[model samples]
Target: MRVYSKTLKEFLDAWPGKKRFGIYRFLPLFFLLGASLEFSMINWHVGEVNFYRTYKRRQARKIAEEILASREST
Candidate 1:
């Protein structure tokens, strides 16, 4: 049996458009993807709920609980 492994350079070299665009070719694709995701997260909502708002509330609750727990223990 034979095992083959490719380094980062070898892997990148195998990607399409590397000859003309180099590593910079992926930047716009990723940037647009991230922008679209952010736009959706901000604009698209499920009924009255928002993902970031819920996440922030949950994080705040956890921190408050931790603070109260520490105060009670002292």
Candidate 2:
């Protein structure tokens, strides 16, 4: 596998494209998106919950209550 990867890298390096803008340039973005998706799926699988949505709702409610309390005080 290491050999395969080395050869693959070499091929990409020699590929016909501007060295500054080759397919390899987008590899990091692809890796980042892939890793993010992988972790997101794992979180959803383990918790069966959308934490971001729930957290947003919780925060919104908290802010609303604070505003209402301040208004009552005024």
CA lDDT, every prediction? 0.83, 0.74
- In candidate 2, residue 2 scores what lDDT? 48
TM-scores of the models, in the order given: 0.67, 0.39
Clashing pairs in 2: none
Q: What stretches of model 2 exceed 4 Å from their correct place? A: 1-38, 41-49
C-alpha lDDT of candidate 1 relative to the true structure: 0.83
Question: Which residue pairs of candidate 1 clash?
Answer: none
* Residue-level lDDT for 16 in candidate 2: 57
Model 2: lDDT of residue 70: 100
Model 2 residue 69 CA deviation in Å: 0.3
For 4-72, candidate 2 gives per-residue lDDT tens digits of 687777866665554777556767768999999977855774355576667778999999999999999
What tens-digit string does per-residue lDDT give for candidate 1 at 15-53? Answer: 688778876878987999999999888788899878888
Residue 69 lDDT (model 2): 100
Q: Distance from true position, residue 1, model 1, in Å?
A: 22
